[model samples]
Target: MRRTTDRTAPPTPPPRADIDQRTAERLPVTLPVTYTIHDPAGPIEGTTVTSNLSGTGVGFRIQQPVAPASPCRLRLTLPQRTDPLHFTGRVAWCRKIPHDSPQTFEVQVGLALSTPADVREEPSFATYCHFVASELVKRYLG
Candidate 1:
């Protein structure tokens, strides 16, 4: 009698290229942030927390859906600086977050900044971004 063997191939890997499309790296952070949506008539302001931060953008959760491409202003205090950093950006995208509760349906918004312009306009912003990226890299990637 001849011996028989069964062989199984390994599973396919995830698509890393699609995931790494972002030009700037993102750091997972939970920090309190206040945001203002610019409107033609008047500006609407609200308080929320940042989910992540990068040189080019930020992510946050909100109670309501924000229209894509809407202009926004963000304010948050980083550990390196005593004063808060202000950023001007636009709503890149928004998606509904599923929850167990019926009364609450939170939305996650991706806010992307108009790079180069912001950093060049504000010297402090450039410094703050550098500090954040360096610190995050040292702590996690170093």
Candidate 2:
């Protein structure tokens, strides 16, 4: 008896060129962060790791569910920064993962800085650069 061999082509995936063009520039730092989730009833606080941050928004992973398109006040504390950053943010999107997963949901929040121009003064970046410069100076001179 001869067995038949079937050769079938696999399905092609959708083109990602449009997605690449529309995607925003993502910063390359994973800053430790603590965020507070503000709701109508009250505020719920949680700890999240900032996957990436830009002048206008940040992406983080949280356990609790946050409604998309809802506005919230966030008190974000970054590592090595003296003062916590506070701002008003809106939930741009939320996605739930599997139940057994450590990260229950991924939330992308868009924050409105107190002043749009104030982003240049983001303490985290400024402080980090200052520290690095200081360290380099010490290493070279000492």
Candidate 3:
């Protein structure tokens, strides 16, 4: 008779505590973003589409690797707005998705807007989401 070893132990998963600290509020709209890395010697510019935006930050995809801790200046054009909005941000984390995929990168950036007063005063959260949704549909669909 062959002896079989007990294999009832559950698999241990990697820690995800960092994910809790980095929770972000998602905006309903997709904004067009042009970002430039601020290097003292010179600046490197790149253009990408923002997946979503929030009062605290924005999320986007990069074609290449960007230094995680580097600061960048972002010029975002909202769907409804005619002028581009300018904001500064620090790259919180940059990681390549799909393990072997080299054509795309996911970046989580923390924005530092010029001032707190710059954000519009909306009466409620639903109103804000509605406004953003409307703009996104108008620009993307219309």
lDDT of each: 0.72, 0.53, 0.57
Tens digit of per-residue lDDT, candidate 2, span 18-59: 565433344544666666666444665776667766545666
**C-alpha TM-score for every candidate:** 0.73, 0.51, 0.54
Cα distance off (Å), candidate 2, residue 132? 16
Could you give the candidate ranking by TM-score, starting with the highest? Answer: 1, 3, 2
Worst lDDT 10-window in candidate 2: 1-10
Candidate 2: C-alpha lDDT: 0.53
- Mark the regions of model 2 whose C-alpha exceeds 4 Å error after superposition: 1-23, 40-42, 99-142
Report the candidate with higher lDDT, 1 versus 3. 1
1 versus 3: better TM-score goes to = 1
Return the clash pairs for model 2, or none: none
Summing lDDT over every window of 10 consecutive residues in candidate 3, give the lowest-scoring window.
Answer: 1-10
